[model samples]
Target: MTSAPSVLVVLPSLVAGFLACLGLIVAIGAQNAFVLRQGIRREHVAAVVVLCTAGDLVLVTAGIAGLGPLVASRPAALTAARWFGAAFLAYLAVAAVRRARRPERLDPAGTASGTERASRRAVVLTCLALTFLNPHVYLDTVVLLGSLAHQQAAAWAFGAGAVLASTAWFTALGFGATRLAPLFARPRAWQVLDLAVAAVMAALAVTLVVA
Candidate 1:
């Protein structure tokens, strides 16, 4: 059998990429807030996790393939992305505020009965919009993570490591946050969470608009 990949050859780059990506991801923002909310509600957890991770992988690949310079040079494209992101965030803010005012019942069967169950397609589309529409996500995961990783290893290997990191991080976040589901069983708790989500989305929207 061929020799196993050497830690010396792989570990440093992988660790670096993981840390870089994690640093970018752990910031309290629209995406993280939305994911945390979904996790707490235990709604379409797998689909949301997979879609988010996959979106990051695609963006990271684009950056590794030298798309960063192109993205940087296109001011109009970035501007449009920012505006679209702001609009999406605004929509989320409104939804969250409404939920905060009138909290949803947590009875799983009841929730499932009302055509309120989150579909996989909806989860995927939401994640794709959140990840791709925000120029910040592209700049962080694609340009920053890609550039940093590529500096430490070959383009393909760096991309591979970054993608792996995204998958691992999002999977852990989606499942790990589920442990807090019990806390959200109370409508009051959900209202609080919804208010927090609304604040985060609005804050991000303001930042996007200003930037």
Candidate 2:
């Protein structure tokens, strides 16, 4: 027994959802790093984008569909997520720091298509782990988006907007990174990017633990 939301309310909800999702997903993280790398390599870029966008869509849709309240009701579940996510992020941060120290440049000649590369299964599995293992993904797409979506009269519309935002962001990140291939051709550039990623992961790990 609910009526449709007015155009004003619906438009605002859509914009809110889009902006919120963009704000959260735009943060540099493992998932984004993989996508950017694949884009730069021109290897399985489409697959990575589709996988990430699909994962986010499902999480956001579920959040809007009422999973958010159930998750909120379970404090223990959130605690477990926080612990696991913090641990994983810490590990990734350490790994990034280590990689930064080594700083191997991408092969300049490897930009062209090559038969010998990361297999489809390997790529899929890696992206899946990067998406699912991160508790922040759940917190952002589920808890945060869910809580906000419910505030709107048309929650489904909000979720749709969020999905669109995710699609746009991943597409851009995966496809746009290739344009920077020249910059990343240098080992120093790779080192700088890895160091920045390490910093971001470390900060996120601390935030998760303290949150």
Off by over 4 Å in 1: 1-7, 110-115
Per-residue lDDT value at 84 in model 1: 97
The candidate maximizing lDDT is: 2
Which 10 consecutive positions of candidate 2 have the poorest summed lDDT?
A: 108-117
> What are the TM-scores, per candidate, against the unseen true structure?
0.90, 0.83
Per-residue lDDT of model 2, residues 1-211, tens digit only: 9777889888888988899899998976778877887887677889999999999999998898888778778888878878877787788789779978877666646553322357889888878877887776887789899999999877887888899999999999999998998887787887898888788778878987998
lDDT of 1: 0.79
Candidate 2 pairs with clashing backbones: none
- Count: clashes, candidate 1: 0
Error at 11, model 1, angstroms: 2.2
- For each predicted model, how many residue pairs clash, with residues at least 3 apart or on different chains? 0, 0
Error of 2 at 74 (Å): 1.5
